[model samples]
Target: MSIAVAVISSDTEYVTRMMSYMKGSPIYHTWRLQLYTNPERIHQLTELERMELIIVEEHLHSSLLRRLQAGGGQLDELVYTSKRGAIPIIVLAAERRELLEHELYKFQSVSALLHGMQQRYERFRSGHAKKRLVTDDRQQTIAFCSTLEQAGKTVMALHVAALLASKGYRVFYCNLERWNTSDSFLAGRVLQEQAASYSDLLYVVKSRQNASKWLAEHAAAVEEYSFYMLRPFQHEADRRGLTTEDAQRLVAAIAESGLFDHVLVDLPAGLDDWTLPLLQQCHAHYMLLLPQPGWQRKHQLAMSCVERHNAQALEELQHKRLLVLSEPYGNCQPGSSVSDLESLPYVEAWQQGDPVLLGSVHYRAAVERCIQPLLTGEKVV
Candidate 1:
C-alpha cells in the first residue's frame, strides 16, 4: 500500500536538487517516487503502478498532459512550478507568504489544489461512488484587503464580489458607507424587518434608500454566493456604538446563512478604537501597512496594537494571521521594500509596489491602482 509520486521537471538542476532533498526525507521511504520526462514511457505503467502525485515543472509537453488527463484514474495531486512563465497554475499554500503576483494569478487558470484535494477527498471518504454534487452550501473563504481611505475599502469590496463571482460562488458586496446617506445611489427602500437574528452569520440588511434599486444594481450572479463583501465603518465608532452591533449582526447572519461562504471584513486603516473587537472575531487578520520611509515605526505601532488586543499566552496571538504590507495611498507615505520589511519576524511581509514609491501623489495613485486587482483574487501583474 505504498503511495507513488511522479516528478516531471524541465530544469535538470531543480529536479536533481529536489530529488536529492526528497531522498533524505522520511516521505521517500513510505512513497514510491518515479522521475519522468518522457510521455511514451509513462503510458507503459499500469493504472495501479501510476503515481498518485505528479510534480511537473514548467514546459511539460501537451501530449503528456492530454495523456495524463485521459488516464481516467484518480489524480490525487499535481504540482506545477517553473522558473519562467511557462506553467501558470497554483495550488493555494498557507505557508506561501511572499509568492509573486504572477504566481498567485496561476491559481485561476489551474484548478486550486483545495478543490482537487480536500473537497474531492472528502467526497471519496464519504463513501460516494462518484463525484459528490457540490451544493450551494459548501464552505469557502474569500480574502479582502484595502488601504485606509474611503475609496480603497469601497473598491476592495467590489473586487471581492468580482472574485467570488469568478469562482462561481454566491456573493454580495455590501458597502455600509454607501447604504443610504442620501448622497449615493442606495436611498430608496424604507422597509423594516424586526426580530432579525444576527450573530457571526452573513445576512442582508434592508437598505433604507432603495432596496429594489440596489438589488438590481448590485446583485451578483448566483455563482457569487461564496462570499459577501462589506466595507469597514469609517468613523471607527460612536457613542451608540454602530460598528460593534452592525458587525456582530453581520457575522451572525453570515454564520446562519448556510449559503454564504466567507464574509470578508474590509477594515479601516491604522489603530482604531474598535479594531480590537473586530479582530478578535476574525479567525485570522491581515494587518495592511504602507511602506513609508518611517514604515518601521508604523509597523511597530500596528503590531503593538494587534499584540495588545489578541493577548495570548507567551506573546503569541491564537489567530495565526500575517501582516500584509500594501502600497501607500492618499496622504500616507510610500512603503518600504519587501526585503526590508521581511526582517520583522512579528510580520509576514508583502510589497504591492513596482519601481518603488517616488513621491506622495505618485505613490498614492500607484497604491490605488495596484490593489484594485487584489480585491478579486486577480494577479498583481
Candidate 2:
C-alpha cells in the first residue's frame, strides 16, 4: 500500500534532497512521492493523483492560506473537502516551534521530517471526522507463535513491541499463551486499583458488552517497557473455557480501541480453538522454528490440523506467515530442512531469566534484524 504524498516546495534543491532521501530509506516502497516545485501545480492534480498528505514549504503554505481566504474558505476546509477527502497538509518551517502544530523544520534529517509527517497525518486522521481513500488506518495486529515450546516466542514478541514503541508508536502487547508467564518478565504498576484479570476480560468479551471500554480502563501500562499488557491469568484453568469466538472478540476489542498503533500477541504453541482465531485475526504471523530435528514435521502436522478444521484460516496463514529459524546461539546453524528461513541470533544471557537482559543493546539488534523485513514492507514468500 503506497501512500501518495506530495512535496510542495519552490526550492528545487530542497525537493531533490527530499526525493533522494525517500528513495534511499526503508519506507521507499510504502510511500509514493510526487514532487511539485510550483505550488500552483497542486491545483492541476487529477482526482486519481490526489495525495493523502502534502508537505509544503512555509512560504507556500502562506500563499495557499491566502488563496483559501480569498475564496471564502479556510485551511481546514481545504483539507476536509478535497476530492480525495481529508488530506493532511504539513508545513515545513525554517525553524522548529514548540507551540506549532503540524509543522516540521525543513532543515532536519529526511528521516525526522518523514517521521513528523507520519505523526501529524495520523493525528489528523484520528481527530477529524473525514473520509479517506486509503484504508490502512486500522491498527496492526501481529502474532508470534511456534509449534514447539521454549522457542522464545514471547521474548521475541516483547522485543519487537519495544522496538516499535521506541520508534514513537503506541504498542499493546497481549500474551495469549495458556501458561502465560509474562508477569514474571514484565513487572509494572497496574492501571486500576485492582487490575482486571484475563478472566474478567474474557467474560466482558463473551457477553458482547463494552469490551473496548473495559480494556481501556484495565489494561496495565508498563512505563519502563513503553507498552500496554493485560494482567496474566492466574491459573492455566482460567483459560480453559476461552472459545474461538472469545479469542476473536478479545483481539477485535483491543485493535478497535484506537489506542494503539500495533498489537503484538504472544500465542500459545500449536493450534487450538483459542490460538487459531488469533492467528486468523492477526495481520502478520511470525512462526518460530527451532534448528532441532522434527521441527518441520511438527509444523507440517500443525498445518494439516488447521486445514482439517478450517481451510480458509490455513490459506490466510500461508499468505501472511513468515518462517523464522530460532537458533540457540550466534554460531549455531539452522538444520538442513530450515536452512532457507530467516533466523534470530541467540541471546544466551536471556536464559538467565533476568528481565533487564531483554532490553540489552545486543538483544535489540538481533530482534531488529529478524524484523527488518516487516519494517521494509517486504513480503514473505
Candidate 3:
C-alpha cells in the first residue's frame, strides 16, 4: 500500500523539479506522486489516483481560501476536485507559513518541501489511518554465525532464506563476512569485475543526503529470488570501513523499507563487538557447530563470546539454539540440547554457479523447522 501525494503549482519550474526528484527516490517505494499544473485539472484524476495530500501554490491556495470563505462546500472545484470528504490541502506560503490551525507550510527548496511533506504525511497517517506498527513494518533478522568456518553456517543461512523466499515471504540474504561470499552464492547475478556491491549501499546509507532516492537508484537485488544482495567489495579497506553502527543502520534501513519480510545474515565464523549489535537484533540467533574432532573448542568459543559480551543484555536470547549437524550415525547423544540434523549432501549446481543451490539440500526442512518459531513468533505453522 503506497501513499499518493499531489503537487499542484502554477510555477512550472517547481512542478518539474518535484517530478524529477520523486522519480528515482526511495519514497517512490512507499509513495506515489502526482503533479498538476492547473487546479481545474484536479477533477480529471481518477478515484484510484486521488491523493492523500494536496500541495498547492500560494495563488491557487488563495483562490481556494476565498472560495471556502464565501461559504463554498467541500465539493467546490477549488477543493482538489475531490467528490467525497475534504482532502487536506497544504499551501506553500512564503509569509508566516505557520498554519496556526491552518494547513500551510513554508519551504525554500524542493527537497525541504518534500521533507516537510514527508513529516506531515507520517503524522496524518499515524493519526487517521489504521496502519501497522513501525516495528511490524520492519523485517525480522535471523543471524547465522559460529566459532569456526565450515560449521555449515553459510549453508544454513542460505537455506533458511531460500525456504522463506520459496514460501513467498520477501527475503533478503545479507552476507556480513569480512570478505563477501556473494560470488560463492550469487556469482552470476550479484557480482561483476568491479561490482558496486554492498559498498554502494553502505556509501549511500552513510553519506546520501537523499538516502531514499539513492537506494532507489543503487540498491541491487536478485530479481529471480525476490531478494537483494550487496555486490562484494573489491578492496579489504572497503569491507573494514564499516563500523558496527553502520551495519546496524544498514539493516534497519532495509527492513524499514518494507521491501523484505526477513533478513537472513550469514555472519563469518566468529564473534566480536562489531557483530554483537546484529546478533542482538536477530529474532533467531543460531550457532551451528559441526561434529568435527574439535567440536568442544568451537563450543567453548561461543560460550566465551557470551561471557565477553554483557550476558545480562543477552539474557533474553538465551533460548536461541546451538544446532549440531550430526550424521544419520554420529556419536552425540540423541537427547542433547543441540538439535541434530542429517549430514549435508553434495550439490553439483555450484559447478554452474546457481545462487540458491543450498535450497535443494535434503536437510533444509530441519533447518526451516528449527527457525519456524522465530519466523512466526509462535509455534511452527
Give the alpha carbon lDDT tens digit for every residue of 121-145 in model 3: 5554433322222224445777887
lDDT of each: 0.39, 0.71, 0.60
Better of 1 and 3 by lDDT: 3
Tell me the RMSD of model 1 versus the true structure: 15.0
Q: Candidate 2: lDDT of 276? A: 71
Query: Estimated TM-score per prediction?
Result: 0.41, 0.62, 0.54
Q: Model 2, 59-130: lDDT tens per residue?
A: 888766555445543356236244444567788888667727877888888889888787787667545522
Residue-level lDDT of model 1, residues 1-381, one tens digit each, is 254556554455655655565576654565565766555557553632444444444345454556645664333233222221111222223243665322221123223432343243223222221112122334332223322432234333444444434444455543333222211212222122221112111224423233333333433332212333322233333212556656555544443455454455555444444544555554443445555556556566656665676555213323424344443242334344543331111111112322211123333333334333333233321
Report the number of the highest-TM-score candidate.
Answer: 2
Query: Which ten residues in a row are the worst by lDDT in model 2?
Result: 126-135
lDDT (C-alpha) at residue 76 in model 1? 24
Residue runs of model 1 more than 4 Å from their true location after superposition:
1-38, 43-154, 174-240, 243-245, 271-273, 313-319, 328-381
